[model samples]
Target chain A: MVETFGRHIRQSLGQLSYAAGFQLFLFKETFNFLGKRRIGLRVLILQILFTGVEALSIISLLSLGIGAVIIIQGAQLPDFLLGEQLYRILIIVIARELGPLLTAFVIIARSGSAITTELGNMVVSHEMEAYLSVGIHPVSQLGVPRLIGMSISMFLLTVYSNVFGLLGSLTVSSIITRVRLADHLSALFANFYLVDIVASIAKSFVFGIIIAATSVYYGFSVSGAITEVPVKTIRSIGVSIVLCVIADGIIILLTMLVTA
Target chain B: MIDVPIVLDDVTIRFDGRAALDGLSLEFQRGKSTAVIGSSGSGKSLVLKCAAGLIFPEEGDVLFEGRSIATMGEREYQQMQARTGFHFQDAALWANKSLGENLSLPLLAADPDLSDYALHGKVAESFASVKLELDPSLRPAAISMGQQKMVSFLRATISRPEILFLDDSLSFMDHAGSRQLMARIEEFKDAGATIIIATHNREFSGRLADRVVVLSDGRMVASGPYQEVMSSQDPALLPVLRDLV
Candidate 1:
């Protein structure tokens, strides 16, 4: 029993060390690409289109649905129970929390899985060897562009989700409660804080890095078989979502401390 | 006499408690074609990979042009790699890029100052040599396996690398296609490129290689000219050579 337990601990530590080393290599290559101006603009632009622009319609629709639901449910509560500052609740829930989280989930579902599968297939086919043989750094040619693009996409999508969700909520509130559009807008603007925006953006940015890095790492980790691609993709998504949530909790806690 | 360009000194590689290469040491003569021949699971490909610096050995060193590859810095390693080209056994083309873009990206990586016109001309020249006339916009999936192999060969040699490594790269081709491709390889050889190939095809090796090394169970059993190795009576190599001939 002791031997088995010790072996398990050693295996876990080895995996952690491997992961940390790969992340360091990725960051170093990313900075190397930036310093040398070898940023592969064409790849970066395509990644932005795939991760950001292509995801806009679904994100907008989902945000609108979420916002309408929130408003409809909040309207059922009595004013005496929550006070007159209902928009404060809406802003806190939507902009400061759900916006970044939902946007990250969408990206993880769409681009994260795709990145992992694509890279995993490349590894299985020995295309990574082809890249290395040609003196091209795969991290600079592949990783950096995806990293920067995904980070930028996450930030933009989070902001977009906030805007559409707020607008949808306002439309629903005006229709149901006979509130003026101007009044709803005024309440939202009044309640929203710069700290909230900062926290949301920071969360999205960090989530983007985590998701991209994790996907690429798992993608390259695949060896030998085609069956490993889907397995790695699932692993990439699961790990990315967990990491994003952990990061979100930490950021929120820090933001609350600073604002308090 | 040409200087040796690559040396594997007492190299050993192990995987999952099994040694794939066991204390293998050999020097590849510059400007000559050498063929590594072995049965499946005999570490023929591992030797090529180790010499190319694609796989570091577990126990010894690989030297390219008198400099140890294990000790070379990133810049120096990249510089060394720029002058060497490796054609994978699977003909590993980048799936995301079209065939032309795949060829162009490496050339651009090596010399970023190359103009688009010059790059296009280079790509066209390589395709023309292989008698491959296809839309450059098409991905490898659109092409047949033989065409993909040709594209991989062109990608490896398009920049005219000084050291070329071919890992069973011509196995998919027929006799005519193999001859055409080998003729093109001869052009590279005539231009003084060092060529190392791992192949089971006896006729192919006999046609191209000056020296042939036969391996079995991760150790070199025979090494010399192709005809000499084939004619040798060494007990360990006899069975493998008989099957090849």
Candidate 2:
């Protein structure tokens, strides 16, 4: 029994080596995909449209509602805490933390699963095999477009979410807290550092790559069987979420350390 | 007489300890139809796959015109792929795509330069060949199984392959449909293309093949001109051939 277990373990390790080589092949193919001018541009545009602009709707609405509620709460705050610290609270939540994280979460939910399943099904159906047989690497042809699209989408959405969230908060503060626009702007500029903006941008970018890669990896790793498809999809999503959370935590800790 | 276009030299493929094709050696020649006949578990399909470069053998080699397919570089592989059409057993049509989309897949795979309009025209020609007048936007699930088979055929031939590999691609068709398909295959054959099909239907094989090769337990049991092999067969295949007739 022990010998059998050892033999299986060695066999699995061998398979894992093959899988790793396959992934490297796929990664190189992605580089080729990025080199294509027309198809790459068109795919990028589609991703920005689908992953960025289209995905912004729900996050924007949520930010707006949150901003409104924050303003209303500030208005009712005992006058001491309401005066100078109101805009600070708004900036910290909307610009620094809540906006980027929530936007990333939304992208993972909406676009991540779709990209994974699409690539996964391609692998399951022997399209990947077909591509390989034809000497066109599947990763270069299929995956790079997705990686580029998702990354651009995540970056744009994060920027948009932050900007919109700030706007919503500003409107609420103006209407409910009687805070002057000039005062809010002066206060924001007084404390804002280039590092903070860089950190937020960097966080979103890393999150985008992680989401796209993990999702795609799961999808492309499915063995060709009729019954294995649904199982592959479930594993892909579960893996993507876990990876996203871990990356998010690490990014937060690193950024905090750097900014401090 | 047709010239031999493909040769499998003592090729062996195994999956998990079970041999799919064990030391199988065969040849498929141009301008002739060769039917690979086998029982359900026999690796007739694997031979076509090895020829198509979809599967690699653990032992021996698959040769296309004396050049090893397993060792060809990417450029050579692409050139070979452009020269052959492989019809998957289940059609393997993209369900999310329409009938036109499925048919156009091979064309798109070979040449990304084709415009949508030109692609549509070429797709129309393939569909016309296969007797399908499918809408460009109608998805696969919306089509009948026979129509799906036709769509797969259109996809397979769209690139104008020099060698055609059909793996159980004729099983689902009725007599009329099969006859129509055979006529199309004959047209392809007349164009100087080689055809190899793995099938169980004796009628399909009997009417179609110039020669037939029977595979049992991943080994070539008998092979010759279809009628000659059928008449002078060993007892192993005689009963099966009689049943088929």
Candidate 3:
């Protein structure tokens, strides 16, 4: 029994090591194929369209709603002190934390699963073998464009979340406190810093790459069965979310250190 | 492209912790045709993939042009991939792509500067070789299974590689389609391209192959010229000859 348990642990560790190695391989291959992927720019455009542009309405709605909630709850903070404290809170939440994280969540649910399912099905159908048979590298042909597209889209969408959230906060302050748009703007501008923008961009960009790599890696991991497609897709999304959050935490720590 | 021999030096592969290929060694000579005959799961496709560098063997080397593929430079490897074709057992067309895009991928990879007109002409020529008309704009799902297989063949051979590796070449075809495919393979054969076919079809082996490699249970049980191997009357030959028939 002990020997069987030990063998199982060894096998698990071996698989974990292989999976980590493959992610590095994908990154290296993507770098090598960056110039080559320009010929297929249509794929990158479509990916941005789907992951960024298409998700604009939902992201706007969610950001606006979150912004309104923060304003309403700030009304509870004991008096006229709400205006000063609220704008700072908005900057922290919308720019440094939730803006990037929420945009990544939206992208993960949409593009990450789609990538995994598409690539996994290709592997099952032997389309990957067909691509390889002709001497085309799958990472270059598929992964590079996706990684670039997702990261670019993620960075831009996080900026949108920050902008739209501020707009929503402005509208709420006007309705509830009768504060002028100028006063709200001045307050937000006073609190917002260059570091907040950098942190948001950094977090979203890293999340984009994490999602793309994890999804594509798992998609290619399906071991030749149709049933494995869904399994790998689920695994891709789970790993991508975990990696994104862990990355987000690390970036948050770094930004704090820089500010300190 | 000039032709070169592909030698599998005692190649072995494993799947799910079991040996899929066990020290199987064979050579496909330049400008010659060889057939690998075996039962299903006998590692016929594995041998073709190993030789094509699509699947690396766990042990031993796949040597192309007298050098192990492991030692080849990126440019050298790319040149060979651009010049060698391997038709998979399944049709394996990219379902999302229009048939034109599917055929255009390898052509573009080989020569990115190829003109649009020239690309269409090359694709048309491949279809014309098999005496079929397929609209390039249509996806693979819109085509019949036999037609998909034909397109797969044309896609593989459209680049006109000097070496051809075909796995289950005539699968999912009608009698007429099979005949047309066979004629096309014969054309490649006569053009002096080195051809390696992994098939159970008696006719493909009997008509196209000069040498036969018989595999059973992941090992090479017999190898020789087709006629000599067929007439050997060995027990392994019985199964290969009968099961193939």
Best by lDDT: 1
lDDT of each: 0.88, 0.76, 0.86
lDDT string for model 2 (B115-181, tens) is: 9999888988877776666687898778878777777777778888888888887767777877888
For candidate 2 chain B, which ten residues in a row score worst on lDDT?
Answer: B236-245
Worst 10 residues of 1 chain A by lDDT: A77-86
lDDT of 3 at A226: 92
CAPRI category for model 3: medium
Q: Which regions of candidate 2 are displaced past 4 Å?
A: A1-12, A34-50, A62-97, A122-137, A167-176, A180-186, A249-260, B1-5, B58-60, B103-105, B115-117, B238-245
TM-score against truth, every candidate: 0.96, 0.84, 0.95
Q: Give candidate 1's TM-score.
A: 0.96
**Which digits, one per residue and each the tens of the lDDT, describe model 1 over residues A1-260?**
99999999999999999999989988888777665453377788888999999999999999999988988887787771133477777788888899999999999999999999988988889888888898887767788888889999999999999998888888898888777889888877887889988988898899999999999899888875999999999999999999999999999899989988
Candidate 2 vs candidate 3: the DockQ winner is: 3
What's the CA error at residue A38 for candidate 3, in Å? Answer: 4.4
Instruction: Show model 3 residue runs off by greater than 4 Å.
Output: A1-13, B1-4
lDDT of 1 at A36: 40
Compose the digit string of candidate 3's lDDT tens values, residues B155-179.
8998999989999988988899999
Model 2: per-residue lDDT, tens digit, A44-162? 67767888888877988977777667667666657623555665676666776777778877887788777767777776666676555444556666667778788888888888888
